[model samples]
Target: MREWMFKSRQKLLTAALLLVSAAFAAAQDGAAGIEEANTKVRSYFEPGTNLMYAIGAVLGLVGAVKVFQKWNGGDSDTGKVAAAWFGSCIFLVVVATVLQSFFGV
Candidate 1:
């Protein structure tokens, strides 16, 4: 019985170590994939990326202004609306950047 218990503990420890190592390896792989994807995306946006970024900045600025107005007590609902618009603008910017980088447009 004692031997069986020892064996069980050893198995559990080994399994735990294996799980930890696998998790670490997976995380590293994911990080590498992300880096590779970013490189690819950046390469795609070579020329038009700047323009898309500019547009995104403009939209973000407008949304920030709207949010500021709400903070100043201009309108409660307006603040929320502005925030949503800001988020949408940011999404658009990301999409544009990705497309420009990947599709070269």
Candidate 2:
């Protein structure tokens, strides 16, 4: 009975060791996965920035049209509205550019 208990304990220990080893191996794969993700994100970054710029351009044009209409209508809040739209467009472009510059990606 004692020998059987010892054998069982050894088997339990062996299984635990194997599980730990497998976990470590899997952790290495996670690092590789992260690296791959980083590379993919960086590859998209420049084009993403360009897309942001394009979106900003489109928004600016739309904002201009809206502001133009407001100005023609003699709306008192036209300046405020125009400023809000212009600020938003600038923010989008600046954020994208700053992120690229900060990350160096």
How much does each candidate deviate from the true structure in C-alpha RMSD? 11.3, 0.9
Question: What tens-digit string does per-residue lDDT give for candidate 2 at 30-76?
Answer: 99999999999999999999999999999999999999999999999
List TM-scores for all candidates, in order. Answer: 0.45, 0.95
In model 2, residue pairs whose N, Cα or C atoms come closer than 3 Å (at least 3 residues apart or on different chains), thus clashing, are none
Q: Candidate 1, overall lDDT? A: 0.81
Best by TM-score: 2
Q: C-alpha displacement of 104 in model 1, angstroms?
A: 6.0
Worst 10 residues of 2 by lDDT: 96-105
The weakest ten consecutive residues by lDDT in model 1 span 41-50
